[model samples]
Target: MQTRALRTGGFDLLVSGLLAACLLTLCGCTSDRAIAKKEKATHVVPVKTVAVETTQVQRSTLQPATVHAFYRAEIRAKASGFVKNLQADIGDYVEAGAKLAEIDVPEMLMQRQVIDKRIERLIAEEQRGQAGVRLAEARVRSAQALLAEASSQMAGAEASLAASQAEFDRTEDLVERGSLQNRMLDESRMKRDSEAARRDAMASSIESAKAEVAVAEAQVVAAQAASDAAQAETEIERSQRQEMDALLDYATLRAPFAGVVTQRNLEPGDLVRQSNEVGRGQPLFVISQVDRVRVRIAVPEAEAALVNPGDEVTLTFPSFSAAQPIVAAVTRTSGSLDPSTRTMLVEVELDNQDGKLLPGMFGQASIHLDSKVAAQTLPSRAIRFDEEGNGYVYVVGEDETIARADITTGLDDGNSIEVLSGIEPGQRVVGPHLKRFSDGQKVAVLPN
Candidate 1:
């Protein structure tokens, strides 16, 4: 019993010594943990930072519009006529100046034929006048020859009269002196009287020849005048024929432009009058050019300032096919807004190289009202919402401390938000660790 009491007392003393050593070790570990936490608290908070930058952003709006052809016309008659042939029908594609229909104007045709016949008659008359002129010239030559013969005869008669008178005087003197007989004297006197009569006749013939020449020359003048009149008449007839031919050419109705014939109301053997007349007349054909089309979109008044000429656009033809939209640009616009609808008319031109677009269709145009507008931007992660749902961002100042900058946002493209006011560009902003940052807290910025 004495030996057992001694061993038990020794085991109890070892247990007490082990408990004291453990307590000492636990105290030292607690003291070290306190010092480590104090050092960490003194260290600055590390944060990712970004700079506010100016960049471009686009805002868009869509408007309803109608598709129209670049050119459209209602072909109508310019002159009264009967439709002789119907060459084109609705939905037929026609080229420029292609014949669409024909008219039969028998009156105009007959008048043209009459003018041609009149012209031929005038030509024949002119030829006859020319022949008459030749005949007149021949008569003038004959008269000249006759005048020459009459002058020779007059000269001969005068010489004979002179000789006869001389002989009569000698014979009378001889008879008085008894040197010549009375019969001889009487014979000489008779010869002289006969010569004198012949001379007077020749003189009359010369005058007649001269009068004939004058008449012939006057006839030549008259004939030439007639020929000139005929030539003038021919010119007049030619002009009349030209006018008649122009009227007859109105017989055929042709296309004014390359287009599709949309309407055809006249047929063969139908009496069609001029469309511009007092009575209500139907158009022979309605044609529309569709190779390219125009879409007039109405832009709202609110976005008028953002739209301008040469802006890119997207056109969707919902009525035709919505799968593929046509891309084009704003070609023009109505500078003034509509008072009733308060919308401005904007026009877009689209190319239809594949012939998919047509006139008289409904479409939608997406217009880039504004794009690439310069603004202060921040990363989307930097924006924070307060209790009132107002947006803000953390901006680090020159002292390495953050401050809450309340900004009015313009556009949010999911990656960045536009800062309309309260923040300038090139300023330092807290990027992702925005929420953890408190106002006026010091932060260590990491290189971007």
Candidate 2:
């Protein structure tokens, strides 16, 4: 009986120990389950919702620029004088040949009047010279008449002498033959000698008349030369008068072109001089043609190749919010690149027929490049660079969680950036952040 009892006690002890072990194992399992439930409830995962939609992505460049008038002119006074009247003021629209200002050029007008008087006097003098020439011609005619009369008298005297010499020769022969008396021979000789003397006297008179004719001819030639000289002087004086008259007319300033007067420098009664420093040509008015305007933009050299003539661009002026964006065409470009800024100069032309655009206005230019392969565009803030300069984004996963993704990027057009690869359309991207946000972090998006 004692042996049986000992065996039973041992069995009881073993059973009790087995029951305790089973209870401990169940309690341990319960504790483990509770801990796991608490941990699962506390862990928060990052999430961002995404929707798929089509969006246009444009790769463009922004350039600062200014508006300029295509045609500009500085109106100046061409003649030196005191300003008499100013017809136009700044901001006045004027047509071509419109009078802008008038100068009081009394001195010039008086000079012209004097020149005119001189011209008239020269004309009278020329007429007098012509009369003198006529008088000299009449004297030449008189001298010719006298020379002809003297020639006729000389011929008569020569004939009479020849007759007398013949008679003398006959009388001398008769006397030698004793049929003629000495007195007859002497009378014949004396008559011949007197006729000869008269002939010689007539020849001398003809020579004197010829000399007088030569003197009269010389006088005529001299008078004609004087008349020609006087005529030339008259022409020169007339030309001078005309030139002075033109100068007087130029005293009135007129618009050089059809444009708006941008500036006015002088007022009425202001004295103007020829030297610009002395306020001569001091831009009595400034005119500019605003029908067409120019915008000069400096584009970075890296992208300058894409900018060329004929390219369309959009511009915005800061002053007016309601103003519509102006569309302009690239008219030309500065072929050389600026070394300081590494930029090229580009000029764009825009129509401004309404005169709404003004020169020297600041603006911005947007130039679109050729279309590239469809790329994913994200808000510029979505991209973050690590310490090594590698860009990445936080992408939402299927379980409403976040995953960090690496992406390659291209041009950033202010608001958005082009995702060349590693991103897709409709992907959720973070907006600009005030502080750095980690990947996989949960975020609540504000209502748009």
Candidate 3:
């Protein structure tokens, strides 16, 4: 029993020893944790910083562009006819007024011939009527001369009749007084009767001449009317001929301006309908002036306001990558946006004297919109973003304390970012690992 009691006492002592060791170990671990906390409070984090600088910053956008001719035209037929001769073909260069094709219009030719014949006949008829008018005028003059002659004869006959009557009266008075013979009185009476008959005949002749003059004048007016009608008919035929000539001119298709033929739709002998006709065929030719080329771009509304005439543009053709890009200035821009597309139309003109640029070619255009000569900027690594997408930077103060500052960014070129606000030139900001630093934390700036 004594032995069992001693073993129990020894087991109690072992337990007590273990308890002391455990308590001491716990105290040491607690002391080490306090020391670590103190060291952390006094520690200074080392960081790399960059100075904010004022430099030139440029903003640009790239958009798809298409090359177009300075002037383009689709030449269509104005007169329906079968193609007879093709003077121009695809890729042919032509000057202004150069004939491109000729059309064979048999019906038009027949109509023109008929008009010519009709005009000739009308002209002849007009001349015949004019001759008749001249003849009528001559007859009028003859009739007037006859009337004048008759009037003179009538006056002479009347004078004679008056003298004869006086003689007869004197003779009769002498006979009654036994101074003259009855035969003498009878002779005077006979002479007076003959003069009166001559005067009456002359008066009748004057009336007949006046009636002839009236008839001649009426004939002259009628002849003149017929001549005027014939002349009017001739003029109407002439006007029809002029209209036919105009229509015939359309059979010869000529170039409206100097250009290269880009397309040819009809061959010789092909029937082409007039452009104004229903169910018209394709155009005869498409001409494009390529001495100068236009690069057209549709700029989105977001950047449309930044685009303007005289701005520089760089054109790169994907199809011709090895070819050097063309540099030109913006020629113009549509001030308003397209309602359907919501994009602004912009154009750039390039001199293509070498004939390298062609219509329908596509490329990309890089346009410089805005530039700042002296803008505050920070390295891209120095900028950080919050959960709301707002950008901030860790600014290192003179006392080496870090401060969080919100900044407005303007343009970024991958390496550097333009700081429009909340920063100044010569200010230092943390370069990278921005999350490692906090507001009011002390830091040691590393040497550049």
Compute each candidate's TM-score over C-alphas: 0.53, 0.63, 0.68
Using TM-score as the measure, which candidate wins? 3
User: lDDT of model 2 at residue 219?
Assistant: 89
Q: Considering summed lDDT, which 10 consecutive residues are worst modelled in model 2?
A: 45-54
Provide the lDDT at 360 for model 2.
93
Off by over 4 Å in 1: 1-54, 58-64, 136-221, 277-281, 296-311, 330-349, 366-371, 376-448
Kindly indicate the candidate among 1 and 2 with the higher TM-score. 2
What's the lDDT for residue 139 in model 2?
91
Better of 1 and 3 by TM-score: 3
Error of 2 at 54 (Å): 11
Q: Per-residue lDDT of 1-448 in model 1, one digit per residue for the tens?
A: 9999999999999999999999999999999999998886566888877888887766677778888888888887776887878889999999999999998888788888889999999999999999999999999999989999999999999999999989888899999999988989889999999999999999999999999999999999999999999999999999998877776766788899999998898778888876665335667788988888788888889888678999988877766573877778899999999999999998887776666777878877888766567667887788887899788888998888989899898776446778888888788888876246667778888787
Stretch of 10 with least lDDT, candidate 1: 274-283
Error of 3 at 318 (Å): 4.6
How high is the CA lDDT of each candidate model? 0.85, 0.81, 0.89
Better of 1 and 2 by lDDT: 1
The TM-score-based order of candidates, best leading, equals 3, 2, 1
**What TM value does model 1 have?**
0.53
